[model samples]
Target chain A: MNTKILRVNMERLTAEFEELPDAYRSLGGRGLTSAIVAAEVPPECHPLGPRNKLVLAPGIVTGTSAPSSGRLSVGGKSPLTGGIKESNVGSRFAQTLARLGIRAIIVEGQFKEGYKLLAVGKAGAELVDASQWIGQGLYASFERLEEAFRDRVDICGAGVVAEMSARNSGLAFNDLEGRSTRYAGRGGLGAVMASRGLKFIVLDGDGAPGVEVEDKEVFDRGRRKLAEGLKAHDVTKPGGALASYGTNVLINVMNEAGGLPHRNFSSGQDPRAEEVSGERKAELIQKRGGVRPHACHPGCIIQCSEVWTREDGADPMGVLEYESVWALGPNCGIYDLDTIGELNRACNDLGLDTIETGNTLAVVMEGGLLEFGDGAGALRLLEEVRRGTPTGRLLMHGAAFAGTALGVTRVPVVKGQAMPAYDPRAVKGIGIAYATSPMGADHTAGYSIAPEILGVGGKVDPLDPDKGALLRGLQRATAFIDSAGYCLFTAFAVLDFPEALEGMVETVGGVLGTPLTVDDVDAIGKKILDAERTFNAAAGFTQTDDRLPEFMHLETLPPHGHVFDVPAEELDAVLRDG
Target chain B: MMEAPSVTVRLFARLREAAGTSEIALQAQDIRGLLDALVAKAPSVGSELLEADGQLRQAVTVMVNGRNIEFLGGLDTPLRGGDTVAVFPVVAGG
Candidate 1:
């Protein structure tokens, strides 16, 4: 099946279908998103202006019968970072779009008059009036869409925060239960979508053409190999670490390592971390009769997601992950999982990025706007965001902006984006990743925690500063994995099992009708990273933008008593070609 | 005879569930001795943390006082009273 690209010009209110460009035929997921943004978008253009474009693409094997490959990449010039950004999410929407033979959808230009929703179906695409959803939160808006568009269709949209043009907003997608919980929640891409007058996007995938595999034999063999490896591995297997407790399992481990950032990076470990840990969360879910070992997308064997419910087990919230737990739980000094879950649900509804919102809330606490560990106060602040109050708007600009506004000099940010759970001062390799990532302090950019804390690939001392080479290798490998549309969690199996790694690459090659070797995967990763770095450089990012917060260098984290002492020269050498 | 050094053995994730507690006080002088005591205390944890040869499992990470054994003296890392020994199985997420 030939791939097609959808170009929607909101200024003209026109939707055009074109053949996939030859230059971009091989690119998919992050590779495709970054390549299009780098080539088409001007580096110095205003991120929320008509010049910026939002490009959405699925992986090469996303729609195929490959396990855990249904991730989507949304890229644009970030209003928050003023650089190239690709935010990723796992949802059935990616598979639906890919099955409709759409390789990428580039939304450009601006419609200042009113809001519109882009609807894509088997026949073609069209723009519809979305005025009613302009200022609505995602939960209410998605419920209305599910009723209007029929529950069988997939949906993605910006929330009320985006409607307010908040820089910390993100794009939300539907989970398996048709709830808008999954998000491409970083880089303020939702503001870009809102700026283009696109409130939501609906996909009518019923009776759509499925992905066509060129070599069924090769695809099946590769799929089988990967499936076997995923089942055999201790961490990725059925009833394994992820399946048993979900991603929150890391809370205890990170706390024990003295790497779980608590109270706005002032400390690394909290005595109450176990209250929000994966094990505790799982126990609560099991006792409350909630679902565990849930899959985020169809054909996902890992089943790391879970349906968390309230105390009485009546209301089913969304899936909970480690990052959300850390950012909203311990980072804010709140140890209760219920409060974190409520905060996470609020962020999902308001179309805000939970990580950024959590960081922002921590900054507000540091500024004495609210007391730390106040779950009720945090919930009230989230309500303010929904209401679009002045203080809420200020907080919605992300932690860096909030920190600057509140005169909090101990802000933990790199390149304007808030750092995630792991304190760089404690986990030094991830610190290097947070500092040097092209996406601005993104944990997923490199994820050195795999080796540094988890011992998934190989054990590395979390406090060691001699990890520039290790971090660089992990970042390159992660780029390739993200491009392939596989869940990052799958790396736990593929890194250790050689057959699984070969199987992932071979499956992509089989789908694209091209031969791909292990070496070629590395090459693709390097090429993608080079494109991103070049784009950031053109956007005026200097070496200074690639350093951690000043406090990280001066303040020593407790337990380990280590500061971020990684040399500047070593950091500069991380992404340098061998 | 000298009194055995007391170390705090901390378990995380599935290991904690297997051990039925987050931490336990054990009397041991080295990392291996602590593991032996841990196995005696919680036999179910031994299967996941150690091999039949009494060596640390490749997937298990053993850290003493917040320092990984690989950076210290491996399984022979000396233990002292009140030292915190954290044992975790291979786990990861983003």
Candidate 2:
């Protein structure tokens, strides 16, 4: 298969196609983005300056019927985390770009004085002047881009928050059904795009340039078997638990395991827990006019997306995921699911990271700005962000920054990125992931839930930090699997059935016309990590940069009454001598 | 009212569906005795929750009041007045 790179110079409104070199054909998605960012962009450059470049690449299995292979990676120097940041978003955009025979799109340099939207399809590329799209929310920008692209296209765009240079801004994308449900929401890459004066990206495939694959029979057989296996598994199958409840399935279980982050990591237990539980959310969806869990991208067998609506059945928003729900629901002390749904919708509309925004709001509330569980106050705070009020500007700067503005020190952040739902003091395995991952404070980066909480692979004690070495190994494996574009949930099957990984690599090699062994898979993963680590090192992140928040070690969590006992020296060993 | 010496041990999922309710009344003091009584009352749930050696199945988690038995006193965790013994089939997915 031949890989093509679409290079767009926003300043001159010029575009060109560059074919993939022999050495780079085997690389795409995380592999391609990390490599390009490492090789071309200077590590010490300002993340949002003209010196930085935003590299967008789809996963290796994207455009193919490989279960959940539609994840797209947006990689650049991060304005938020200040490290090698590659955030994944699942939308029709990745599949559309793959169908256009494009492996990656390297967006370089800032545009001339005004805003513009970059549209790419199989027909070629163009930089359309979009001064009209300035100050628009994500939904409005998407609608305008759709109108300009003749109403049918995949779009990857930023919101007004991004244009305003909010530290928590995100790149929003449409789900399979065209709601803005998918988010390339981590590491503040949207800030990088906004800095380039690129407001939005519209992808239309009026023309088709399907990627080539050798040995059609082998590829077809592999695809059929993989989809069948997805159907067979309860997790990704039709009408499965994930379909019924979305990722909120972890709500009750994680809470039961005493790992749910509640009241800004003050406790693992919530008094009004049932109000936000997955079972309750499922029931609420049935009552409200909302869609149950569905795929974010087409041809995805693992449909774990859900739509949430107001109580009166009006303006149903996108998926209410685990992280967002926890961030908006328990962490902020808001128990009403409708309030959570509205907050989630507001974040998507504003194109802000829900995790970071929710965390920032919680930090402010904890500082006595508002009473805990004040849903009304939360709404008002979000409105302030919309109007770009002074308080709003502080909130937009993210959790750590907001905490500093409030003169509070209990802020939970890793390398400038706010922590997600799980408290590190409770779920130590994922804590290790948050402390060690190149992407700051991202649970999905490593996802220690399978063993630490859910006991899927093997029971790893949640309170024990003895498995630090094992957690790092799993993180490496997970990074490779993610780069390959396979859904992380596939690990459940891959762990039980080794043939699953073999099948995936074989199918990837079959499609790309390159032979890939399991060992090669490991090496590819190591290379991705090396590129990220090298970039972070040059960007001035050191061993001390990886340490968890100071409050985690001092404050003892409730129920278990345990503090983060993993010695900083031991945490340092995660990347040390490796 | 009458001299009824028994207790109801609750099982969830398939075990409960077979036992006909979340809880079952059985007369047993120890874990082994509880299984024997459960098998005497509802044979199907007994087979699902226990192995031939009378040990609990690894796939099933037997908890008393949200605490895993293994983490607590194991089978020796003594039952008391109104003790809620719950059995849950392991359900792991996405």
Best by lDDT: 1
How good is the docking of model 1, as DockQ?
0.72
lDDT at position A175, candidate 2? 70
lDDT of 2 by residue, A1-578 (tens): 74688988776677899988777778778888888899889999998888899999987778777777887889999889878888887787888888888888999998859887787776688888878877767766676666666766888877778887887888998776566668999888887888888887888877766667765666666666667666765455677546766787666666665678888888887647667877678778888868876778887777788777788877768788888988998998998888998899889888899999889888998988888799889989988888899988888879989899888788989999999878888878888888888889988777777766554566666778776677667777777776777777777556545566677777677777777766776567777887888899999989888789888989888877888888777777765435
**Worst window of 10 by summed lDDT in candidate 2 chain A:** A492-501
Q: Candidate 2: what's its TM-score on chain B?
A: 0.76
lDDT of 1: 0.89
Clashing pairs in 1: none
* lDDT tens readout by residue for model 1, A246-309: 8888898888888898998888787799899888898999999999989889999899998998
Model 2, C-alpha of A416: deviation from truth (Å): 0.9
- Candidate 1 residue spans exceeding 4 A from truth: none
lDDT of 1 at A352: 88
